[model samples]
Target: MINLINISKSYGENHAVRSFDLTIETAETTVLIGPSGCGKSTILRTIIGLISPDTGKVNIEGEALSTANLVSLRQKMGYVIQEGGLFPNLSAEGNVFLMARYLGWDKDRIEERIDELCELTKFPKDALNRYPIQISGGQRQRLSLMRALMLDPNILLLDEPLGALDPLIRSELQQDLKEIFSTLGKTVVMVTHDMGEAAFFGDKIVLIKDGQIIQEGNISDLIKTPSNPFVTTFINAQRNHLEIIGDI
Candidate 1:
């Protein structure tokens, strides 16, 4: 559903993305995994138009990204960043309906969407009136997810959505998120440094290194027939943890 072609970006002399090319399939989850500063998030931001590549282009459903179409294209996408990115001042319901209200959605329609999202994200109705600080970390992330899905966009872009949570909470949310993605069948692109998380959520996993794609495939593909030495090294580095989670 989204494609990045020959993309390159640099900050000062450091290349953030180098000659990158990737296509995210429709109704499937694509996980971008790498070490910190490897540019996976940069690629995600590029797809969402937050970062313009110095070279190459991004295409969403065959439409090339440009300023003229950026706003319209963005409305079709739901973005959830790390730590939930919720407004501390806004109540849970307020945060979820922020965009809907801005777009002039009628009260009934907004409430209906919020109800659906709350149920989908397993957020409590009683907590809707609470602020972000009043909720637990997991609940805050759920609220972030609700806010993203309030518009019912066709694509979901998440950058380390579960990175900050404790392991147990993160595991629980991973299962919940996987079910949500399967139920919705939206195009999903997520970024993480954890191989276990990638294997759990990704239908296609792209392993990146030094601003370049080192390998792209299923977890088994990377384990069995690594594209390069770095691919093997990356996998082995996380193999023990992956084994505890079992094969995907």
Candidate 2:
């Protein structure tokens, strides 16, 4: 279980997140969905320790996320950013093994883990030598997943993981990712602007506005009995998408 208790963050004078609170249970896929700049990514970053919140703290599996435990705590979590975030200079295998190598994993051990992750992400072993530029957008995402899962973390944090792909590729990845999540049973928190994606990927949806949670529930609960006008408005804005994706 993960607890984001009373979390808040700011950028100079702008508040990115405000008094936010959320609990991510083990094996559940929780999605942070909202409009652009609504602080969805900020929450993910804060949870992953990419940046500290101005106030409050995070807890993973009953352990507090502090300086003393951050490193060790992070070892139990995997993070993926938009478009794979792969380094240009490294090959797919290199990118996947970078962290393991830094942790002093032996060559054979690293290779074994890489092979396992490749199969898990459904990536071709022969293409491991290819750089980020040499692969398709979808493939880069698979590589990114492989890297994130190489350590076999219990929690997965993703920020717009499929935001860059074309509709066809994006649709394919969405299904694949759903299956992957179901198979892994890892706690997941993902940020996305697409309601369709949220409806499809998330077991529970958390909608935010002005850095605060507007509503948190499953798709049917939000659509059938909205807490406020914004909930209705937000869903109406993406009605076509929700219907097209057969989510409605």
Candidate 3:
């Protein structure tokens, strides 16, 4: 389990996140949704120790994320970014096995894990030899996911993982991701702007605005009973007009 207590971060005088608190249990998916610049990405960065919180504590399974434990904690978490963040020079197989290799995994074990991840993500076998630039955007994103899962981390953090794909590809990948998560039973935290995507994949949804959580609940509950006008408007904007009824 991951526990975040009063996590906050600032960039110069502007505060990106303030007094944020959240708990992510094992084997569940938590989706964070908000408009642009709402500090959604900041929260992910803080959790991963990529950005230091001005004042707060982050604990993973009761272990504090201090300098001594940060490295170990990071190793136990998988992080996927929007751009895929793949090395241009490396092949898909190379990228997927990078972390395992760093951890001194044997050649046979690394090969087996790479093959398993590619199959899980439905990546083509031939794509393993290709570099990131040679693959399509969707394929790159899938490869990025495969890399993150290579180590079989207990926790997965995805930041707009499907944002770069076209609409059709985006929807397809989203379904694939949902199924993968279900089968793997890994704890997941995803940040997305699309409410429908959040609703479909998240066991719990957290809505944020101006670096603060406005509301949090199951997607069905939020849609049925919005706490305020903003929550109603946000949900309506994502829903088809045919699905929305009454004053929203």
What TM-score fits each model?
0.96, 0.94, 0.95
Question: Candidate 1: where are CA atoms >4 Å away?
Answer: 241-248
Global local distance difference test of model 2: 0.91
CA lDDT of each prediction against the hidden true structure: 0.93, 0.91, 0.90
CA lDDT for candidate 3: 0.90
lDDT string for model 2 (151-179, tens) is 88999999999999999988888888998
- Across 1-248, the per-residue lDDT of candidate 3 in tens digits comes to 88989988888888888899988888999999999988998988888999889999998878889889888889899999999999987888889888888889999999888889888999998989998999999999999999989889999999999988899999899899999999999999999999988999999999998888888899988888888789988887787665666446
C-alpha positional error of residue 4 in candidate 2 after TM-score superposition, expressed in Å: 0.8
| Candidate 1 positional error at 199, Å | 0.6
Model 1, range 4-88, lDDT digits (tens) per residue? 9999999999999999999999999999999999999999999989999999999999999999999989988999999998998
Clashing pairs in 1: none
Worst 10 residues of 1 by lDDT: 239-248
Candidate structures ordered by TM-score, highest first: 1, 3, 2
The count of residue-pair clashes in candidate 2 stands at 0
Better of 1 and 3 by lDDT: 1
Weakest 10 consecutive residues of candidate 3 by summed lDDT: 239-248
For candidate 1, what is the TM-score? 0.96
lDDT of 1 at 9: 100
